[model samples]
Target: MNLDHLRVQIDSLDSEIVRLLNERINVVLEIGEEKKKAGAEVYVPSRERAVFDKIRSLNSGPLPDEAAHAIYREIMSAALALETEMKIAYLGPEATFTHQAARNKFGVSVDYIATSTIGEVFDCVQNRSADYGVVPVENSTEGAVTHTFDQFATTPLKICAEAYLPISLTLLSDQPSNEVNLIFSKQEVFGQCRSWLTANMPNVKLSPVESTTKAVKLALETPGAAAIASVMASDMYDVDVLAENIQDMQGNTTRFLIIGQEYSAPTGCDKTSIVFGVKHKVGALYDALSVFKTDNINMTKIESRPSRNKAWEYYFFVDIDGHVEQPEVKRALDELQEHCTLMTILGSYPKAEI
Candidate 1:
């Protein structure tokens, strides 16, 4: 074909694509109306997951799944905004890891509110000031965020979805690494980079801050100072990154949860989290866990925390590899309940992609 003919063909394809997109939007509007009539949530996490999964299955593309999903995320975000205004709450003054994870799940087009503390994030959702909340649950290097686990013990909120953010910490500074005398970041970030900091800046001071973004701001204003933070933060703060991937582990990841009023239905592959307290007796916890073994269910994680209301008492949290509504899971919980002082199904959500 001639150059002009090929350009004409491309224009024609673009026109059709635009028309199809409009048609899709109209249909989505209709569905949104129907959902309103039935009083259903406009942002259904299970439905959203199914759409992304279908996109992956249907794509035979030059674009990768991650890239395609990112595009679709914005499209969905726009539709969701039109359907109903969504306000997502996250831990921050802005530019925190939780803020980035909130964007990862909700997309850049949606509204966001940065809360001073994780408790305030939950309070925003609980008070109906925000439609949903996002908070960090666990880090690959540092284990669970105890505050999050503890919050679940009292909060009525449930996890609807999860986002796994691969964390790459960068060394940002106003001065060169050799001459830098002060370092700042969240305690967790410093712990993750302990070895590197010990070996490279042995005599430099390490200070824990409220957030990594705060550390960046401190580094910017203070002389002979540096901050270990996300590369995105470096760009946002206009600080030079002295080094990339400075974390001690190559694949450090943080799991963030999307918490709301209700849990999502099963999406075939699911995970359920629950917290319970075993009765104070010998073999009590052991017999309690055996319920899963008898039911042939896979338990992914188990954690314990002191029940602050009762001295020396503890609560146990567990994550298992199926929805709570599944027959085996249901049966296991039924059996397990007999040995526990209390049991609560935290939430059942789609398993995050590897």
Candidate 2:
């Protein structure tokens, strides 16, 4: 065929594709409405996974399977958004790392609220002010976010999903001045950029702030001050990016948790989080953990927290291989709970796919 003829045919095919997608989306919207009535969750990672898996299996792609999955994820996201108005709460004054993580998970279509504190984020979810809350849980360089751990122990909300976002720090300041007298960032953030500070700006005073956004705001207001924060913060606060990706380590990352009222079903690949307290006896903790080993399950993470009401008592937080409802997981939990004075299943959530 001639070039003009081919171009016309391609354009016609593109138009047809759009029309078909729109029709499919309309049907998906009706399914979402039915789900709402049946109390089914909108964002089902497992169902989405199944869709991508089927596509990959059938795919003989010049476009590639990953590309196909990417297109489907957005389509699903848009369809879910059409079902209900989702409100997401994140730690913020806006432009915070938590805010970015929330946006990454929910997309820009949902309503996002930036609360001043992590507790506020949790409260938003618990009180039904928000559908979900996103908060930083751990970092690759620094350890756990203590407040997040504390919330898990106290809050009724469950961990619905999790994400690990690479934490990139940027040094931002106003104007073109290089005379940086002070560095502002959160304490843990400072630790991640420790080597960079030691090697480049050792003499500058480091100021620990409540958050990255606050640090960036201070830098914008104060002369000779530079804020070490995510690249998004610099853009939000209108500060010049003095340095990009200034984290000491190349693979610096932070794990964020999604707190919500709903529980997630097993995504085939799932992580179940539980908390239990055992009587302090010889090999008590060892015996409790052995349930997983007996069931041939993997323990992803374990954390110890002091019981608030009782002195000398401790609560153990665990992330295991399978969903809570799975046969093996159910047996393990039942056995483990018998070994403990108190036990709680915090959540059985779909493991972070992205």
Alpha-carbon TM-score of each model against the true structure: 0.96, 0.92
Winning model by lDDT: 1
Off by over 4 Å in 2: 1-10, 52-73
Error of 2 at 260 (Å): 1.7
- Ten-residue stretch with the least lDDT total in model 2: 43-52
- The RMSD of every model to the true structure, in order and in angstroms, is 1.4, 2.3
C-alpha lDDT of all candidate models, in order:
0.91, 0.85
Q: 1-354 in candidate 1: lDDT tens per residue?
A: 999999999999999988987888889999999999998888888899999999999889888988989989988988888888889999996778888888888888789999988899899999999999999989999999999888999999998888899888889996888889999999999999888888888999999999999999999999999999998898798999898888999889999988999999999899999999988889999999999999999999999999988998999999999998899999999999999999999899999975
Off by over 4 Å in 1: 1-7
Clash count list over all predictions: 0, 0
lDDT tens digits by residue: candidate 2, 78-170: 776777887889999788888888877776677888898889998998899988889998888897787888888887788888887888899
